[model samples]
Target: MQAVPNAFSVLSHPSLDHSGGGRASSEVPRPATLFESAELLKGGKIVGIMHNGSLYRLQATKLGKLILTK
Candidate 1:
């Protein structure tokens, strides 16, 4: 008999749609530090890519990927 490979599902596409149509917003008014981001991540919040030095969160899904709200 042949062994079957395990299947997997992508939780989030880090490149494709982390922004979520640019609708998400940032809770932090000022620039967030790495430690802050870590805290957010620990709370199950997606950490968006830093662009021009800013952090944001997903507004729609509430559990989706992060985006540059600023």
Candidate 2:
């Protein structure tokens, strides 16, 4: 039988530096909640979960178009 690969492993990469004072020249306007979600999606490195009356972000890879659960 073949062994299954671990999913909790994390790989690190070098940081990116932008010379234009951190802001891009062409930026699109977005909703505050959506902008926050996108930032959380990028920086959080995990998926967001909702439980009860509040929302929580968790660490898990997304699979296709299926719904995610914690």
Candidate 3:
């Protein structure tokens, strides 16, 4: 199956009448990085993502899909 666009959009949809009523809808500050998909490769189909002193592995699956792991 394919991934849906804006997978996080449901959190802000008006149709959901949650008690909070969009209190946290404002943008959360995040570090932005401009990189291309090709740059993620080290040599093969693997790359590394660093966050909070932890290392994460991103790899292209045999099925031509991406998977991330800690």
Best by TM-score: 3
lDDT of 2 at 2: 31
Whole-model Cα lDDT per candidate?
0.41, 0.40, 0.64
lDDT of 1 by residue, 1-70 (tens): 2322321112222333355674333442332222333355666545455666776553324555445465
What are the clash counts of all predictions, listed in order?
A: 0, 1, 0
Pairs clashing in candidate 1? none
| Per-residue C-alpha lDDT of model 2 across residues 1-70, encoded as one tens digit per residue | 2322431121111122144454432553232221233444665456766789777655434542323454
Evaluation by TM-score, superior candidate among 1 and 3 = 3
Q: Against the true structure, what is each candidate's TM-score?
A: 0.20, 0.22, 0.47
Q: Candidate 1: where is the Cα deviation over 4 Å?
A: 1-45, 59-68
Query: Against the correct fold, how does model 2 do in TM-score?
Result: 0.22
Using lDDT, give the best candidate's number: 3
TM-score attained by model 1: 0.20
Select the stronger candidate by lDDT from 1 and 3.
3
Look at candidate 3 and give me any clashing residue pairs: none
